[model samples]
Target: MLGLKQSDLASKAMITRSVLLGLEQPGRKHPDQLALFQLRDALIRDGLTFVDATEAAGEGVRWAKPSGKVWVDCLKDARAMLGYSLDELSEKSGVGRYVIARLEKTDRKRINEEAARRLRDVLFDNGVVILAEEADIGAGVRLRSRVRPAK
Candidate 1:
């Protein structure tokens, strides 16, 4: 489901394939907290968000923010959450400043996948999590950490 091979995910999570398999199966004993943390980190690093179960809905995954406002607003909001300027984002993402400016200032939907990927990667790398709307969780942006470390 996370687009990762079991062996690759196990390696990334620093756990054995048997352990990962155990976690996947329903009847096995739950993994220790450290193993779970490792797995969570591996998934989160790839932009997979694990929303906790709420009264309204069971747990689920979100890839990006839900559609509504222009996607460019989402980009700008994420950049703002990371306290990065357009120029700074451009430098970090290797996306042109004009492209970013247009995204932020206009409602154009012509951005290529690679360009969008670059923008999203830079924001995610900076700890800005773009959450999609779940059954109850509304779409929004939040930082993984309130006090982010220097890049």
Candidate 2:
């Protein structure tokens, strides 16, 4: 996986983080083809290759080549998909907001494992799919549906 901040990736992809966050929602409508291509190209430059489903595995993304640096944890992706602000997630999960932010940045040093578990549980309970490693697919997260009803 590549290690780029949302703002950085959005810049390279010619998209905004808000757009990237919207696209992450499961069951959301697709963006324009040009925007999609831009995002794909940006990710390709970051060493990801989009995979197509076959007999051995399902459609997903894979590293096109070895890359260094730890990527942001799935927590941030799931949180965005669920539309929960860090403060909201912290309150719901009973984890400190600071710690939640740290986890999102992949800065887990001195972080409590129990606190992280609690945070993950909150995300899972509210319709986020915490994907585990399967076949060659890496661990990731997705939303099953939006967490709250639309206004």
Candidate 3:
């Protein structure tokens, strides 16, 4: 989920790899509260919602369904927020210039979901998160304060 490996997740959360592995293990649970909080915060920032156990449902993670229109409206903003110009976005996302323009249009234009996903994945991988629209609140685009050190 979220197209991430365990090592990537651990790095994002700033948690040690062994600690995260222990937390995931069946019998070797790691009860580091601070690490748990860090991981939770990182996941939340990654466009996931955590559902607590209810009478009818067990605790689970979910990616909220973003409003398509909202996503379209903000595509350009997201690309720009990443400090990527149109050509840069095209290169990174492998979405054509025409498609990007069409998706950014206020009026409906034909563009498939796959193209959108390609663009979205680039933004996600680059630390931009598109927030899902909720009742009484409109959708939003947020830039994570992420700065990974050079390898």
Candidate 1 local lDDT, 1-151, one digit each (tens): 3446799999999999998888877565546788889998987786656555445433434544333443344677677656788899999999999888776654575766677778988888877766655554335566655442255
C-alpha positional error of residue 29 in candidate 3 after TM-score superposition, expressed in Å: 46
Task: Give candidate 1 regions above 4 Å deviation.
Answer: 1-67, 70-72, 135-137, 146-151
> How far out, in Å, is residue 43 in model 3?
28
Tell me the number of clashing residue pairs for each predicted model.
0, 0, 0
- TM-score, one value per model: 0.47, 0.59, 0.49
Report residue 69 deviation for candidate 1 (angstroms).
3.9
Per-residue lDDT for 1-151 in model 2, tens only? 4667888888999998898877766778656677688999998887666655445333445455433322235677668757899999988998889888888775466556787688778887886655554555455555544334365
- For residue 14, give model 2's deviation from the true position in Å: 5.2
Note the residue pairs that clash in candidate 2.
none
**Model 2 clashing-pair count:** 0
Candidate with top TM-score is 2
**Ranking of all predicted structures according to TM-score, beginning with the best and ending with the worst:** 2, 3, 1
Residue 5, model 1: Cα distance from true site in angstroms: 48
lDDT per residue, candidate 3, 19-82, as tens digits? 8987776565347889889999888888766545445333434454554446656677667656
Error of 3 at 128 (Å): 0.3
